[model samples]
Target: MSKMTGAQAVLECLKREGVDVVFGLPGGVLLPLYDAIYQSDIRHILVRHEQGAAHMADGYARATGKVGVCIATSGPGATNLVTGIANAYMDSVPMVAITGQVNTWLIGKDAFQEADITGITLPITKHNYLLRSATDITRVFREAFYIASTGRPGPVLIDLPRDVTVDEVEFSWPEVELSGYHPSVKPHEMQIKKAARALMDSSRPVIYVGGGVRYAGAHRELFELATKINAPVTTTLMGIGCFPEDHPLSLGMLGMHGTKYANYAIQESDLIVAIGARFDDRVTGKISSFAPRAKIVHIDVDPAEVGKNVRVDIPVVGDAKNALHGLLKEVSPKARSEWNEKTETWKKDYPLRYIPDMNVIKPQFVIEKLCEIAPDAIITTEVGQNQMWAAQFFVHKDPSKFISSGGLGTMGYGFPAAIGAKMGRPECDVIDVAGDGSFLMNSQELATAVVNDIPVKVAVLNNGCLGMVRQWQELFFEKRYSATILGRTSPDFVKLAEAYGAVGLRATKPSEVEPVIRAALATDRPVVMDFIVSPAEKVSPMVPAGATLSEILELEWCDVAQSCHLEKIYAEGRKEVLGQEEF
Candidate 1:
């Protein structure tokens, strides 16, 4: 054991945990910690805001499957990290956020720049700490990383008071032992068998996937199980990159703005083999009507999630990879020819499409071009229509290729996230698909990018308004468009990019989309490519709020005709099966 200041011990602990980089900002209270950071070999990316640091760490974690770290000062600095912490918490991203507090003597005295960061982040973090002594520094850092990266991974905070940082103590890493925090990693044999039997007996089975599968590194097992059982696979928004969308059984994303085929397939399936998926309201649409005909076999690491959203016929609570391994033993290969045929018909009937208009560029067309240009790039998205469009148009074949804020749906997440992703995977292409309103939120990060020489690409879908909210206003609220539009006074994104010493390109027509995207991709410096898309264009096949999946509304008549035709085919098939076979 060696004697050292708490700040030095913190850096040492981080080094032990394989943390090479941190995203953060410094303040008065963090002086000692920043001094320690400066002396250490660990790379620190100075962010414009504490919130950006949190998001950058979150993005780093999501991209690399490693625990991300961020630091901030007390009071407003700590508070600024709240939204990013909440975003990571809601999406189950593994992160550790450290904040410096005022001196211990000043505690509870309402000192300047003093606020209870631990209390403020209580609801958003998996676990948090308030360091009362230098002696506990090693233990706290160890536990923080452990808790942050463990089962149901999420953001964990550690508050370091100024006195604690300056105090000297002999340190030794403690053996982590916590009584009520064990996560189940093994499934019951009987439960696995029972789930297998259910899947075997069902004529129409669909596998519903979520982010947990990716987090647990269970995609291999998940893929094997689905392929062996000949079941169609539909993923939640968070699960987009977990399954190969190009696969024959891939139904792409389901629910809300999910593919028409996926929604229909889930509604018609007899069995839902849900893997690491929570039945979020967006995915389920109307809960009462969602998968009304199906029995669900829910496999998750968290026992609390088994029946929290929907009733499960078989609840196997364990690590998703292990649970999938258990199921693989009991499940046998079977040709689901009829079910496959139905899904194929659905796929053929309603494909994601848009009418070609050369005058005004459609956002979907831009995304399609991006897919063609950099199919293997790490794609992050800002919330709203850009997110939905990215989910729909981008074909993600590998896990971790797509990252976004799902549960919280935070805007301005993608750019910083892309930066973090680029930092984590320098060789891989990192692109942030963003909206104009969302991009402007954290666009100041352009300075961070240029300063650090992190060449992340940004695709701004500029519609001159908050397109998603405007769509809602147009459809449901009688076009009472509230403070959504940015108007003509909005800053020119290309000029703004130039101001940041970054390349900026704009595409106004349909033909210009591909070339502009290509130009952005070719740049070695950070590039912001703004595509001025139509303000009137809306996401199609939308299931209106409070509506069931079957009641999805299509933007065009051709889509309506196709959906109707698929329903007719299904009705006829059901009648034939009822009259003749036991299927």
Candidate 2:
């Protein structure tokens, strides 16, 4: 066997693991790896910020169902990736983050660029490795990739010392033999049978799906089982497109801002077949009251998540597709005419509705117009109001169509994620649905788009404030509006786009919305549209925290007309009816 440098070992390991592209920024400590990368076949994408690199890797992993890879150097470079790593950890995206560390001798000595990245990222990663020797390079990489892409997929870190990357060792890529780290891919047979039995017996069963189905590539299996059993489906925010929103059985998204009918169905169902989804607090609301009457059959790839939050009558731990297939075979279909009728009643009563007033421009209207113009376009969104609005208004017909920071809810995710998604699927039109606040956080990436000649359209909802938080403060905190307003004299986003060498448009009136969006789409260069929407608008049908899913408060048309002054209307109307005698 020939002697190879640590950098060569890393490249060999990545090749063996089938890593095609790496998202990263190079630095002094990682010069050896960069040198080897120059000679290797793997492609490297240099990002503007290290955080952007990590998020790009995350987007790639979520879109392709592969373990995304990212690299950064010691100290500050590594520290910059912390937010993205945490984002991946929260969402359980499969990724491998490799960082260069100071030489082994200087690790604990507070050397110029030294930081304990492994220690810093321990809570946010599935596992982490600190490589002290050249021999450990190959094994650490193999282990990191395996852990990242396997069961309960998450980010894993491998920190390499600068000296180690240049050191020479005998090169022989050994097959990984992890005796102590076997993941449970096969669900227990008894648990599978129990789940099957539950499905067979229930009359009012609804399948709740989430991102795990997408991760496992089990969309077909999920569709097959749901169709076979005639069970209506509801999805968490992460599971939006796993089942097509237009499907007859699909009840759209369910959560804080979920459809009223979807939340009601969960309340009334007798059996909830939750597949590849966690009962996140956002979805469940109050654990004690959520789906109070329903028996749950929770199936997931991770055993630890089986009963982490909600109690499960049946728990199946395996690949979601495989386990679902096993259950389908065991269960016999049952008739449930009454249950279907009840759900249909709820659907008709509380159908998703938004008034399109010609006088004032609405955010939902812009989203709908964009959807009409670019039906198959890929969409990335920042967190908060824009994210929820996209989920509510956008119609996604394809899998991997909508990319956003779901679990992490990272604010500045849209622009860079759009860049990465565009890079991954270049033929498709990619757009970032961003709020003004979130857009400013990563607006710097417009330079990256302009430099690469990537024609990503950014639709900025310039509401002049943090709209979502302002809504909360308006409703719950007595309209104090603390630190929520962007105030007057906002940055000239159009001029900013022009300065970055990208096309810009401003849309204020409702009539200008579609024309501006179409203009952006017509461009072959990066474009940003400053869509000035109504600042007073709020995402309605909000379910308060620690409340039951059924206890949703819908903001009525009258409420909107009164500018959220519901108490005054209530007092006046009731007093008039009662002749003020009771008072």
Candidate 3:
């Protein structure tokens, strides 16, 4: 047994666990860890901030379906990682976060840069470890990675004190053999049969998928099941691109800001097969009223989520891909021509339509144009309306093509996530569809893109307001637009892009949208385009909290102006089509 520092032990443990890369920023307490890293085989990516590192790890995990690793020093460094860790937790992305703490002697003395990172992150993590003994390093590291990548995947933290890093320890890697800690991925046979029966029994059925599918590596399984059942599939924000959006059976996304047909289908379905999807409040607004008439067969890796928000007739606890394979074996193929016909009728009737005026360029039209220009580009989005717009308008033809922070709904996620995605697939064109408010959160990372020569296009939907929250207030809170307006006196985004040594363009008119987008695409450098969109625009088919899906408030230009009491013709000369009733 060779003598090694705690930092060395940690690195040895990571190498044993097959971790090849770590995303993080170095700090005072973590100097020894960095020293160890300098002599190690593991590749380290130094992000601009600790938060970005966590997000980068998260993006890598989501894209590759592996345990992503991240490191940060204690106190401020650990705190900065909180948002990204919570984001991964909410989305069920597997990640291991290693942080440095103050010396063991300063545990509770409130020493310089000392903070109880483990305590701070307990709620957001699957599990946390504080290495009090050098010998415990190997075991804890093994356990952390196992916990992170298994069952309902999530971020796990291991906080190591600075003193521990300098201590000598016999280097020995322990093989993972914790029986109690083993997470169960095999669903009970009875429950699996029940889930299959539910699918077989229903005439009008739809598969509602969530991010759990991606975590479970069940995209192919999901596609197979949907094809066999001949049922249309819809995704939550986290589940975007899990099923190819370009597929005829794919219904895009469903919820408050989902496609008109997709939302209507969920509202009217007789049976809902929910896989690896927690019924998030955003996805199932007015929980009691969501899928009012449907029997839900909920399959998730985590059992706690089975009935937490939405009641399930059949709750199957297993990995999504595994459960789908089992269910597919038990269930026989059945025709639902009537159901398919109804969905088709609804799709043809209430198609997602946007009236593009020659005056101001519509955000939806711009997204559609983007789809035309870059059909296979990897699209990431910032939270809020821009995310929903991208989900609705972008035609995703492949699984894992769309990336966004769904559960955390973090605003500053797009730019950094885009960077990670670009790094992951250098050959693919990556774009961050961001709103004005959200873009500013991590726009500083444009330099990261430029310096790395990661040609990611940044499309800013410059509505000059916090679009989603403003829409919510206008609809439900009697138009009390408090702090929602992003007035004209905002930062000059073009100048900001120039500051980062990136190309910037401002497109204010409809005619200029395509040309500017093409120009950005042609450039090898990072490009930012500020598309001045209509601020009066509102996302439609909003089913407010405690309301039924059928009770959707269809938003139109008139509704926008009426709700805000605006005198201007919000959507002048825009055509409207009446929706058809189908089930």
Each model's lDDT comes to 0.89, 0.85, 0.83
lDDT by residue (294-331, candidate 3, tens digit) is: 89999988888989987888889888888989988988
- Candidate 2 per-residue lDDT, tens place, 1-583, comes to 7898999889988998898888888998999999999999998888788888888888777767788898999999999999999999988889999999998988899998888999999999999999999988877888888899998899999999999999998877667788878878788888888888888888888899988888888888888888788888998877878888877788888879999989998998999988889999889999999898999998899888999999988888888878887987887765656877887788788876677777667888889999999988888899999999898888875558788898779999888888777777778898899998999887887877888787889999887778899888878899877877773236788999999999999998999998999899988999999998766677877798888999987865433553334334334545665786766
What RMSD value applies to candidate 1? Answer: 10.5
Pairs that clash in candidate 1:
none
- Deviation (Å) of 236 in candidate 3: 1.2
All candidates: TM-score: 0.95, 0.93, 0.92
Task: Give per-model CA RMSD.
Answer: 10.5, 6.9, 6.9
Candidate 2 lDDT trough over 10 residues, lowest sum: 562-571
Q: What is the lDDT of candidate 2?
A: 0.85
TM-score of 1: 0.95
lDDT of 1 by residue, 1-583 (tens): 8789989999999999999999999999999999999999999999998889999999999999999999999999999999999999999999999999999989899999999989988999999999999999988899889998988899999999998999998979898878878978788889999999998999999999999899999999888989998999999988887789999899999999988999999999999989888999999999999999999999988889899989888898888899899889998898868999999889999888777666767788889989999999999999999999999998888778899999999998999999999999999999999999999999999999999999999999987778799778767888666776664336799999999999999888999998998888888999999898766678887999878998887875233343233335435555765689765
**The best candidate in terms of TM-score:** 1
**After best superposition, candidate 3 residue 476: deviation in angstroms?**
3.2
lDDT of 1: 0.89
